[model samples]
Target: MSEGSTGASVVPATVHLPDDRYIPVRTEDLVAALAREHDAFGELAPRLAHVGEALTRIVSAESGAFSRRIERAYAPFNPDRETVTVGDVGGDRAELAAILAYTFDKANYDLLEDTQVRAAIDSANVHGMKVRVDREKVEELQIFVRGRTQETRLVRTIRRPIVGEMREVELYRRLAVVFRMQNSVEVNIKLFRDIPVADLEALLPHAEAGMSNLDRIKILGGGIGAIGGATWKAAALLVSGTVIAGQYFWALIAGLVGLSVRSVLGYRRAKHLRSSQRTHHLYYQNIANNAGVLDLLVTSIGHEELKETLLAYALLLARGERIDGADALSRAVEAWIARRFHVTLDFDVADALESLDRLGLWADRATMRPLEPEPACARLEQHWRERTTEDYHARTLSQRG
Candidate 1:
């Protein structure tokens, strides 16, 4: 059996590959391995694949990987026969919130089993108390969250439309969005405050719009096509080789081969032009036009999105800082939040820390003080620090010379 990618020493089962090599798969990886095998083999390969999957399921059940009773609980929500694996259902609050949000947003609220539905209700109530959601009108709740997702997409899309002097402005807007997710209202204000007064005014309405980035971009693209309709028609003739006579059928065939390529290029050019014009128009808008842009941007972002985004960033930052054990890291983060955002943060640090371990960001404990960084990550960190120090020395020497 070949060892799994996780590189854990434990070998629960051996899988004989098409090659002579046998892969040693851990108990937790049994179901996954069976799935990979099922996908790799064609229908004519053998019924052995099915038997193997069934055996793996039996082993998983016997080893208490997941209870049959819990699988039954997930059945209603997963009518497509998709298994909502044990690891998926079991996660930290932020992860659970993301899963529940996605499930509800996709209009699957009523289909959720009792456990999942309860979890969703509890999370929405806790994170979004001010927003009222009727059990019957789960879609209404989804609409609110959906708007935030759209706005974020819009914020990211601004990069394509904007360039040059407004690049910093766009960065500020993005940082505002990120900081806002961390519930840092003051930081958002500070970010917006730094932007030019005219630019801020121009950005306000576009940012506040309920339309997503893709939707707005499509609208602009359509407008561009209308204006440049003649150009497109001429290009289509060139691309289609419809102008060529029957005697030159080979030319027509060549045109057909390049048809898709031409269409793609035409679409790209039209999109770029549309984005440029739209951003230019926005750049020239009057400052008086958007009086409440700041408030609009702030209110549009949802609580759950902010928390999830912040948690992800916080975990990444913790890894970079090489923060010590769960307890120490939690205190450091809580203090950082208090200092930076000036807000009281109440969360389950242990669960968050456990999630880091599950993600392979945190190394398993050997002794106290977070142990030494795992060699895999430690080498990279050391290289970066050394490079930074060398750069600093070179810069000082250059200035002195």
Candidate 2:
């Protein structure tokens, strides 16, 4: 029952994924691409559409169930909830965290370890600001990121303190964080988009931003210049001897006091500017919060599940003889995506197989072959019928009781 420990169902480390688990193509687009590559897919296009629809329904059902589980677990900590519940708050909080971790995994997000978070803060980011997170104030913290892509960004150079455009800048397309404060047991959920990997520390709730080394140097140099100017003016006044002794003394005092005030004001202005920059960066990145975060996560889970299922089945049908096992199928899918969409990713073959197996489309487990498109569509329709019938009976029984 640690921070990220979910008892027997611990989430696996996804650090091996080069990009992310997300398939960067739409279902329809994927089908179209497959048809263009394989003539058989063009002939079975209608059946493939049917299979896609059926798989979507199944994934949607699973997503809805998981969403309910998350909402129930999160009820106690939901800040926007109107009702106050009287139960074991601690137990509810742990359950919420566990469900959220699972949801993040299902959504194909990679959990950021403490070490990784620290490393990101230690590294330089596009924004020239030093960020520090107060770990002592945090009772629990979990960060999950997904859709990592290399992008171009303007970053401050270390050698000359000049900004330049850097290519292949890694960034997380989506970021989700769960945080609980030491003083309060209530959990906080936050979701953001387009977070630079090096600036991940800035997303923390208790993160404090300070002026970078370059900014500090500028402030220090300005203060030194002000002092030098004040000293020169004082020396000039005394050397000229045009004013009386009391007048010269007051002039020196005024010059020193004004310099001190100017230095303080300059420091404050620089600090405020750094803080404003951090705020502006985050303002555009934040996407959702609290219950809204759960909704987005659930939706994402459904989308990822559907995409994986479609790709796996399509690959199996198109190249069933070539695929020897799950690994081979994964490679085939990955290669196809790289060739077609120009994106490389680590496909979650296990999850895809599980979905196909559940839908009864997986014909041979040993060979990793799926049923033909026409038969697969029929089987999925039958499965959907059974599911709907079971739901109808369950609802009927509940209403009667």
Candidate 3:
């Protein structure tokens, strides 16, 4: 209860990832859960239903950009020339795409140029052939895309760390702590349970957050290779072959080196990536449950317009920290919510405070102080130190070593 810091952010002696720590978030389960919330939609119910339906369609869609690329760009480069293999017709979409890419790379690099690869590409380019993808492969790719996209959407809508109006240095310190936690026990459920309920209570915004940074890196690597190769070929073609020795050689070498560095960076960036599907699923379910609680709080003590604002404040209060005294905190939270969700909502502080008081989130009658984490939440944080993934991996490695 002291005003001082929480003991310089102690680093645990060990970290451990639970053996069954991550469970895959099944897309079907998410759909089922979303479907259950349909009747609870009220005025926005129809719109929500439409989004869910769109999700279904997207996940079920057969071909993707990669699939189309395989069909359009490389399918004609098939070596056999026995039949016109449009897209992934031979059930080797992935391999064929890779080979086609390698062929293009060889053309640009002019290194170990395979005669057969050149012949195939030249044939395809002239013949104007397209590729066909296997139905099963297309389905697999779709599912992967859907899973990645949904997790991205969930994080975009939620998973934000809310900050109080502390000093700039203090704010950076808090953010540093958040970054560290994100790397360590943030993956664990105990730590998740320890997160302030208020942050979790805002529910998800409708928009999808787009592909994650890691996924974007993967795309970047491929894009660089493809674009760089094409650029080199185009530039070389513009110059005469008689003068190709000086300018062409230097350009090709420099471009290849640049492409190699980017590819390595993208690959290295990918190594630190951890899938958040399980965490997103857990948070998704939490949002649904919290929605019911917020609804009850609204019905009991809040106005129709004040429902979301009250919910946000209640979450902040229950989250185990006070931003300001009751009156000031209430006003600040209302203003922030109005601005944060301005397009979708209007703000109301009076009813929101009343709701918070009714819900026991208000610290005391007069001062309206912030409440500390519940005993259960404190216990969860304590438990995380003893059950960290770092400890688990260390022990396993020691045994194996």
lDDT of each: 0.30, 0.72, 0.30
Give the Å error, residue 165, model 1. 38
Question: Once superposed on the true structure, which residue ranges of model 3 sit more than 4 Å away at CA?
Answer: 1-202, 241-279, 283-401
Off by over 4 Å in 1: 1-329, 347-351, 359-368, 371-401
Query: Candidate 3 on 1-401: residue-level lDDT in tens?
Result: 01221111111112111111111223334334333434332243233333333323322221132234333433343332355545554344454434333322211111112332222222110001111222221111100000000011111111231222221110000000001121221110011222211122111121112234435656676968676775778566656565655666677667777777876676555433322332353353332121222222222221231232223333353332454444555444444434433422223345445434433433454655423335323332433334422132123223543
TM-score of each: 0.20, 0.84, 0.18
Please provide, for model 2 over 1-401, each residue's C-alpha lDDT reduced to its tens digit, 9 standing for 90 to 100.
01221111111232232348877677668755665654545565556766787777776666676667677778877778887767665455545655776778877888877777665555533366777778899988888888877676554454334643343456678888888889886788899997766677788878877877767778878878877876877777778777574587687788778877887888889888888888998999999999999899888777888789888888788778888887898998898889879998899998888778667786777777788877887887787666743232124224544
The backbone clash count of each candidate, in order, is 7, 0, 19
Best by TM-score: 2
Which candidate, 1 or 3, has the higher TM-score? 1
188, model 1: CA deviation in Å? 28
Error of 2 at 61 (Å): 1.8
Scored against the true structure, residue 374 in model 1 reaches a CA lDDT of 38
Over the full model, what C-alpha lDDT does candidate 3 score relative to the true structure?
Answer: 0.30
Angstrom error at residue 51, model 1: 44
